[model samples]
Target: MTSIVTIARLGAQADGIADAPGGQIFVPFTLPGERVNVAVSGKKADIVALLDPSPLRVTPPCRHFGDCGGCSIQHLEQQAYRDWKRQNLIDALRARGIEIEVDALVECPPHSRRRAALTARKTEKGLLLGFNAALSHRIVDLEECPVMLPSIVEQLDMLRGLGLLVAQTKEPFRMAVTQSASGLDVATDDSGALEGPARQAAVEYCIANGIARLSVDGEIIVEPKKPVIMIDGVAVIPPPGAFLQAVENAEHVMAKLVVEHLRKAKRVADLFSGIGTFALRLARQSEVHAAEGDAPALAALDRGFRYGDGLKRVTIEKRDLFRRPLTYKELDLKFDGLVFDPPRAGAEDQARQIARSTVQRVAAVSCNPITLARDLSILIEGGYVLKRVVPVDQFLWSSHLETVALLEKPKKRR
Candidate 1:
């Protein structure tokens, strides 16, 4: 049944929430204080009509805005959008009792995302290629995605050709296409096996299109050129399907904050350092000891350093930080400052270890706010003074925010 309700607030995922009869209703595409006529079913809602629209709502840039699921808040105005993203970070820090003022949201441009994580499936009609719809398995076949680099969007036809030739499963599979300095690096997962004549056709397609590399199920089919991503003028070739920051602009912004914070330190330890995104850049000034579990990533980091000139001495360690965090003893005298950018789980065990260490400056770079808050709280409990944090909106229109937080552990009594 359709019902009129006033949105109370935005949920963590940017869904509009309303107090309903039993508990609450979540409606997408609605902003707080907007009275919407929604079709209510259980705890879910679909906008039948907007009884009252929030002034914050504006005309979304793309025609696929509501359906693509690549962006959530495109309808929101620019300043209000920035404020909402920044407020989320502030609220997360406040929950941890670290009430320092967070810097304004570092707004990334619409077409700056270098990485596009999409879903694709082959249908009788043709091949479906795009991101999955929000909170559903259904794919929204994209005509255009404003958030991704035009370099990637322009090559979608080529990607679709590969999908048509190689896709063996009717079910949707992951299609990750990253625009690197070299060319478009493509990887697919769970798309069934590619063998026989289909494989040959796919290879031919990549060669003809000047695709840098193509990998399916982590196995490289062809690497025409080394997929190199420039890190502040330094070149680093990552392994196939490796994880890097999604936005180049955001990566640079975060790196600047980290490097400046640890500039005074002669030596720095970079933990969870994948492909030396920060460690390689940090080596421009400070000697860096980079630790990460991915062997290929570490090797890439080492190679990038050796090939590039004028960097300080750099070392690499291959260890799972999640399983075996660096102990306080190892961390104490090894480095003057430390920077860690872990996966979404947020390095709790590692954070606890860092809290016990005597490292003077700590830079915590995280993508998830909840886990970041928890980890920051642990450091605070160990007497680290929370300085300030800057929120980076690399994932434009999405709920995700990249944050850089600086902390300091006071010197012990002499």
Candidate 2:
């Protein structure tokens, strides 16, 4: 049935939500205040006609905006788009009973995403390669992706050719590509067995195309050059399919915030430090102890620290922080400051320890606002003062935000 409804707000997935008589309806590629005539089914609706269009809705830049799931809010005006993104952080914190001021959302421009996980499939006709469609398994064959680096987008044909070379199954597999300092680093998963002639072909194609490295299922196929990503002039080789900040500019912004915030500390504990993005930079001023679970990442960080000169004493420990977070007794009085950048599930256990410890300064970097708010509340309850929260737009046009928060504990009142 076709029904008209005015969008009340944007949901967490950036979908427009309308308060209907039954309940709420979600419409993709829509904006608030727009009266849309939608074909209703269950709780989902498809816009058949626009009775009224929102002023904030503008022309999306990319032709693949609606089809490609990589970006969501491209149709929104720039200022309004940013406000909505920033409000996510504010609202998340407020829900945790901590009303704090949040900085403006950091701008991430087009062609800035350094890493992407794309889908590839081989059929009887030919090879198919691109990002998966929104909430679907179907892959949208890419002529171009505005969010990725031009170098990566321009070489789509070459990637497709390479995909044809290594595709072992008819079902779609994954290829994670990252733009490194040397060249493009590509890694694929579920690429069955490539041996003898097939292996030789894959290796030759990568070398011929000047790919920095190519790996399948965590096994290196060809490494013409070690994939290097420079962090504050310190070049660190990232392990195969390792996690690094998605955008270079956003990483630098977060790192600068961390480094400046903990500059005065003589000793700093860098927790969940992957490839020493912040630890290596922080070592220029402070003695650093970086801990992480990934052995390869920690090894690469160790190599970077050992080779780099003019940095203070730097150390690395391979440990699962989630399983065994540093306790308050272990953290107390050992470091003046601490910096932690955990995965999407924010550091709850570690935050509890930091709350109880005597660490004077803390910088918490997070990609999820709800979990960040939960962890920050723990610290706030333990007497740590929430100073400033800056939201970085690493994942542009998406619901995700990278935030760097600075907190401090006052000295004894006596």
Candidate 3:
């Protein structure tokens, strides 16, 4: 049934929420204070007509904005869009009962995302490669993507050809492509099992197209050139399908915040350090001990540290922090500064351990504000003061955000 409802606000998922007699209804692609006629079905609604448009609503740049699942909130005006994202962080912190002044949102420009995991499938007519539809498994073929680097988007046909060559099963698979210094590094996961002929075709395709590296299900198929990502003048070769910051500019912003905050410390420990994005930069001044669960990533960090010139002492440890977070007893007040950049789940166990320690300075980098706030709350409860929080818009037009939070513990009383 079609119903007209006034949008109350944008929810956590960037969907317009409307209060009705039954319950709250979520309408996608609508804005607050706007009246929209939607076809309702069990708390989910599709916009049948836009009755009253919001002043903050702007025409989305991409033609595939609503169809493609890669971006959200592209319709919001620039200033309003930024404020909405910044408010997301504030709301999350407030939910945790921790109130503090959040720094302004750092906006990453369009066509800045260097890494993307796109879905691919072989239809009866031809090969389909692009992001999946929002809340659906169906793939939306991309004519143009405003969020991804043009270099990556320009090679869509090439990627599709490669996908057609590698994909063996009828089901959909994932192709994770990253724009490295060498070239585009393509890695496939959940693709059909690679038989002998399929593997041979994949190798030939990578060599013929000059792909930097091609890996199938974490196994390297062929590497024309080592995929190297330069971090602050240091070149590091990450493992196949390794973790990397989505936006280069945002990475620099976060690193600068971390390095400046820990400038005075003589020694620092980097937890969950992936390929030493911060460790190598920090080693320029302070002695850095980088620990991470991925052995290959740690090895890569150590290699970069060893080869790089004019850096302080840098060490590495391959330890699973989730299983055995560096304990307070283990920490033993050894380091004055610490920097941790964990995954989306947000290092809860590690945060608890860090809270009980005597670390004077800390820089917490997270992609999820809710978990970041939760971790910050734990630190604050343990006597650490929340110094500053900066929301970074790395994944532009999407609900995802990155934050760099600096915290400090006061000196002990005599």
Model 2 lDDT per residue over 1-414, tens place: 999999999987899999999999999989999999999999999889988999898999888888988888899999999999999899999999988879988898989899999998997767778888888999888888878999899999999989888987888999999999999999999978778898999999999999999999989999999888998888898889999899999998998999999999999999999999999999999999999999999999999998898999998889899999988887885899999999999899999999999899999999999999999999999999999999999898999889999999998787
TM-score of each: 0.97, 0.98, 0.98
For each of the candidates, the C-alpha root-mean-square deviation to the true structure, in angstroms, is 1.2, 1.1, 1.1
Give the C-alpha miss distance for residue 377 in model 2, angstroms. 0.6
Model 3 over residues 117-233: C-alpha lDDT tens digits? 999999888789999999999999987899999999999999999999889888999999999999989999988778798889988988898899998898888999999999889
Q: Which candidate number would show the highest lDDT if scored against the true structure?
A: 3
Quick one: how many clashes does candidate 2 have?
A: 0
lDDT by residue (46-126, candidate 1, tens digit) is: 999999999888999998888877888888889988888888888888887878888998888988889888899999988
- Of the two candidates 1 and 3, the one with more favorable TM-score, higher being better, is 3
Query: How good is model 1 by TM-score?
Result: 0.97
Q: Judged by lDDT against the true structure, how good is candidate 3?
A: 0.93
**Of 1 and 2, the candidate ranking higher by lDDT:** 2
**What's the best-to-worst order under lDDT?**
3, 2, 1
Indicate the residue-level lDDT of 199 in model 1: 92
C-alpha lDDT of candidate 2 relative to the true structure: 0.92
